[model samples]
Target: MTTTDSTTTSTGSPATAELRVDRLETVLTPTERPVPAGPWTASLVFAWRAILKIKHVPMQLFDVTMFPIMFTVLFTYLFGGAIAGSPREYIQDLLPGILVMTVAMITPYTGMGLNQDIQKGIFDRFRSMPIWGPAALVGALLGDALRYSLAAMITVALGIAIGFRPGGGAVGVLLAVGLLLVFSFSLSWIWTAVGLRMQTPESVMQVSMMILFPLTFASNVFVDPATMPGWVQAFVDVNPITHLTTAARSLAHGIPDTGAIAAVLVASVVLVAVFAPVTMRLYRSER
Candidate 1:
């Protein structure tokens, strides 16, 4: 004999005896299918989720808060006099360059975070949702804005404390910080692409360090290009980090280097154009 869900037998397993047919139907066949979120709405939701994560694990801001302090303080005191005559003299230049470096360095962590999510099956769940495809990636990037802003603020405030003064004043500093954020946002797209292609978060970090170390150190970040060997100077001149640091230093000091600013902007555009689509493709290909 066949038994329908409506029929119940108290003599059988207790679990089966208490089964409810209506509850099963309600789940298997909902009254209405939920509407999919709009692209902007979905992206924002993921961004908010990122903030909630930070709320629970406050230490997530460790890199954001600590990097600026160490780079600004350590470099300002240790290498300042040797490089630029005194800590004060060096800080005037060091602060701006360090600000750019600090933010740029943290960009790699974006990839690490993405890789972690992928391993934890978080992205799988995200992909299964009926939301915009890029929402999760874009939202994580949007969340990173807070970290970048915090780094900039801490670097600026600490710089001022140590004798670094922005001749351009508050407005100029704000403008410089805004530009750095824009460039950093574009820079992060490169890492997201790396994150998707790499098998593990550690691998992503290794590649990122290899790329970033050369770019930041070989650039005109710490010292004047004129003092470097001709070949190194040649490379530094074309390095995008150099361009960004030069432009940021100019803006913070109130001079505003238009050519450098233009170069940074162009580089930002190129990075996004090249990497953003690749990241999306990789994100989609993942099973």
Candidate 2:
């Protein structure tokens, strides 16, 4: 038989028994290592992550359904007669502008949401992962653009149901949709920059809405530019959304708006040139 002895210590006339202890260290090995990703592949991976996130959070769909109904009802019935001399004519005149407005306003969530993730530390996890550089952020932006496309199409469909018909054939309609997306994507880059730099998501929302509303409404969206006062018309003429709305209207009405298309192209190129580097820099600086 073996006996184990415990050491006792005396403190202030009281004897206390002490148990010996040892500290243990643990090491965990991952089952798999991250694989190297090509640039485009990494972008796609990040884009897919954003899409999956959208699936879990579905409040975004409300905007898709609501905007079309709201605008269609408001402009068609409320101010239609005052603006276009008839409600039906107003619907015809304003549908293209509304389509352009919807696309431009709704798509910024892509960049804004991504920026929120970064500000909230979710992006830190992605940064630590083996995802490709620029993939997580840029891919997320592009993925959100898909939502904008869907929303635009649905809104256009609703317009059709409400007596809005495009004089342009399928190809013209397709071109209009394509141009909306292109411009929206470009605009999103600016929001992406803002979101990346901002400390809170709410700030992003407020700032973005402040900028978007004036841009969308002050243009030829609900009213004709000819009816606008001179100062307002000057502003609208330079506004990128004006070009987009004009281009959409031209395509829908089967009219040639070569100047509007050129304006859209120029504005998109300028926005991309301005915001892309800024967003990327903000992304890297966030590290």
Candidate 2's displacement at residue 167, Å, is 0.7
Score candidate 1 by lDDT.
0.91
Model 2 misplaced regions, further than 4 Å = 1-35, 129-131
RMSD (Cα, Å) of model 2: 10.7
Clashes of each: 0, 0
Error of 2 at 119 (Å): 3.1
Error of 1 at 189 (Å): 0.7
lDDT of each: 0.91, 0.79
Candidate 1 is scored at a TM of: 0.89
* Candidate 1 local lDDT, 145-262, one digit each (tens): 8889989999999999989889999999999999999999999999999998898999999999999999999988898888889999899999999999999999999999999999
**Per-residue alpha-carbon lDDT of model 2 for 187-257, expressed as tens digits?**
88888888887777778878899999999988988877897799999999899898899898888778959
**How large is the C-alpha RMSD of every model relative to the true structure?**
7.6, 10.7
Residue 149 Cα positional deviation in candidate 2, in Å, after optimal superposition? 1.5
